[model samples]
Target: MTRMLERAPNLAILYPRALVKRGGGHELPDTRLGLRDVAVERERLTEYHRVCGFGPSDTLPGTYPQVLAFPLAIALMSERAFPFPLPGIVHIGNTITQRRPIAATERLTFEVRTGNLRPHRRGRQFDVVTEARVGDEPVWDSTATYLRRGAGTGAAAPEPGEVLPTTAVWRVPGNVGRRYARASGDRNPIHLHPLTAKLFGFPRAIAHGMWMKARCLAAIEGRLPEAWTAEVRFAKPLLLPSTVDFGVRGRDFSVASGGRPHLTGRAVPAPGNATPHPG
Candidate 1:
């Protein structure tokens, strides 16, 4: 079953629901959530571009649709029928596929669902799938993998590979998370002030993974094709107010701080203009 809506549900309203709804089931909710005719406000879009270091353009950034679709993703995860608690779940990886450049003026329809639950070395993992469309044609889609830590499979952690050569160094400000939160509406406590992050076991505030992805895309914006895919696996937490090294090799890119990688990702042109999944 799918529940369709004409407007986006408020994040302010959904966050509380996520806090109160406890999850422990083995099966995921069978229903999918959809929102139609979602408008794109230019002012908000520009702010997002500025915060993520993207230069001005008529088309939307590849990661922008995820921000537009995020509220519904939260709504789906906040359901009592969901199988994992929202509070402690971790976003481990994400892959975004863009069929073509979406104009900032285009009205979008979004749909979200979850599946592919399986065991992980640290605990369990699952996918939160979201897609965006202009009318009936799919324009963009993403799969965000999340982990819920608990009993492990006892597998050895994967070893780190050779660090890529640095091309540039960036000084990330302490308030980057707040800026991105305002732009993207993802105000996870760990990404906020140091005091709030301490409650989550972090010594200081951390960067948002999606923001890291968007920044990486901005770094290689000139090289991206009209239609493409970008994927990233997040590793260490990037502490706030740090200077980090950025590197790129062909279509691949990485970010590191204190000689440790915080993220690794790549972007490549989509093959043959194939239609993207509608989710």
Candidate 2:
């Protein structure tokens, strides 16, 4: 928690350096990242909402703040002292909470810090904690959990989630990952190209878990409050150019293919939350 880095990070530059960062990525230290004066461009925001299947509106999408804070999270995770490499790390789950509605007109401040490494059956895991604020008011926060397979104590893996009946079928093209990467700045190779994915043991390019979460939120967007929390667990990889079953029961939802679960989660109203933001 000592060294604090502040900059308007360029994804194009940072992404390449992250791939070959120093320190073997075995040290778990708390590092702070700050990006002040963050503003939302309406045009870009609209495209993001469209790509994620959410209807465009003046109010920010529930999951968009996390998308805003992701580059800062990447800066922390790619540090030499981090416990795992950026490449091949699996995004197992994500939990996001917003205390109040976030309007499109407000300027934002983003802070990201990474710590809390612990053992998992598959290997090791850690959380990248992020928060977004408008001056002193907290708008959103998230705990994105990732697992580094084969880096832990070999304990029993966690049990699976409930499997619901297929509600809808989706044809996810191979380029969807690349599309999302362009919008979200998550140019992780495993999700973009089949050849790069094979290097990491995936048979084909895979979908971004966050994209799945966003699409899930879009499916039930009108129902969610401006301020709410969503907890999503990524059960398996959604292969690109694939068809998947999407099931949503009230606030609980799931995406699966061939009986294999890909993403599962629930959305709940935040404390004192009532009305949705108006356009």
Candidate 3:
């Protein structure tokens, strides 16, 4: 019975002109690739590709966008000029639609824009839409909602809607962290190369964000009613060699570790859906 906020009529205006004026528009300089570099032949995409747990010959994994997308969102939202408290937000859920396959060596300019904004019954919780583009072409898009902790604004929590009970649970082992890094091309030293992690303030290599995402999807597909829409908040990053417990209860779902909740979400069966496959 947690209190939540009612949907706002002007929720879309949260990213006000003032907030947009505070900083440059959503532009990721580092992500943009010069046209000349876009077609260059390189072996890095094929060689030394263990970071994502994928061989150079393998295709980019589904959750690969997190390496750049979420970071870009954080950077834009954290501008001191912006009104919302970026750190206080929780990533409720993420949905990504890929228009085409992304080559590892392809260089391109990337941009993001905040789109739809819908308020949830939970106080201060709002759904935000983010769209990513490469050189004027929409490449991928995700809609994520977040719960603003400690922001007591608007209405009381709504009664739990249709309940979809848990079906199964999965235990994510520490080693899967390493394997995920190898499959994805993200060799961020934080997820591999222990020495690099130490320099970056981590005790050891941590799990790739995408791996955790994949794990979540796997859990949901196994338990909840099929076709349920999921909205999740990333909250804090989960480190390596950690044990994660994923479970479902009624229509509510939760992922936890060390007795602490890492993600909280809900799901329902997809209309005209079939059985889910192992991810």
Candidate 4:
């Protein structure tokens, strides 16, 4: 674990250059990267919310803090202790939770760590955890799970959630993926142009799963609490510039297209001040 390092949110995209991979032993140990004092940037937050379709509110969007802290997370992943390459890892799922609605003006301290490598039917999997707090009081956290495809451990993947009957359809533009790429700074060639997508085995550009999660949250924002946990399992890759159906029943929700599910998720209440918030 490294000592706390402070930085501005805008530089998060390139902070990893300072870290060189020092591959770790088998455990994939838990190392505290550093502490970051995040001063919420309202302008960027509003832009992010706009791109993801969240209606503007004085309170920060539940997922915005995670984005602000991502640079630090990237720096942590760049450490010599990390085992995988920065590219090519597949994000299989994610979980985000918070004690209450975080105001735009609230101060935050971000703590990041990674661990829990395990076997999966497709390959190996691990988690990246990010936590934010006000002084000593915790407010929000996220766990982003990634899968490295290779040598299967024979551990079966988790069962998929039952698909919910859809209530609405969204006609996504062909350029939606590129548009999101600009806003999210995830310019993965696979999510931008068609030619680049085909290089990665995708027939066309695919929408970002995080974008899908944010869009889903925007649709059901009223029902989500400042104190809520959202767990999302990524399914079929969403073909860009296509229409997708959405359905929400209770804590269960899903996004699908061509009668196939793209993602299935559950949103539930979370207690305030919990530590090591699971993703």
The 10-residue segment of model 4 with minimum total lDDT is: 11-20
Model 3, span 1-279: residue lDDT tens: 111122211212333322344433333122211111122124433322343334343333334544444434454454453345543444545655544545444443434444333344443554444443444655444565556555455555433222233344444455655565444334445666567667767777766555655555544444543233444445345666666666666545555665565655554443322322121
Residue pairs with backbone overlap in model 2: 123-152
Candidate 1 stretches with Cα past 4 Å from truth are 155-162, 272-279
RMSD of each: 3.0, 2.3, 11.7, 4.2
TM-score of each: 0.93, 0.91, 0.47, 0.87
Taking the tens digit of each residue's C-alpha lDDT, what string does model 1 give over 54-112? 99987889999999999999988988789877877888889999898887878889989
Candidate 2 lDDT over 161-256, as tens digits, reads 666788889888889999888777778888889999898799999999999999999998888876689998999788898999999888898899
Candidate 3, lDDT over the whole model: 0.45
lDDT rank, highest first?
Answer: 1, 2, 4, 3
For candidate 4, write residues 1-279 as lDDT tens digits: 556885643433443343234445556656776565567666667777887889988777777777777777676666667777655578889899978777787778888888788999988899999888877777889999988787888898875576789888888788877777666656667778899889778999998888888888888898975589999999888887888899999878899877788889999988854333221
Give one clash count per candidate, in the order shown.
0, 1, 37, 2
Decide which is better by lDDT, 1 or 3: 1
Count: clashes, candidate 4: 2
Candidate 3 positional error at 32, Å: 15
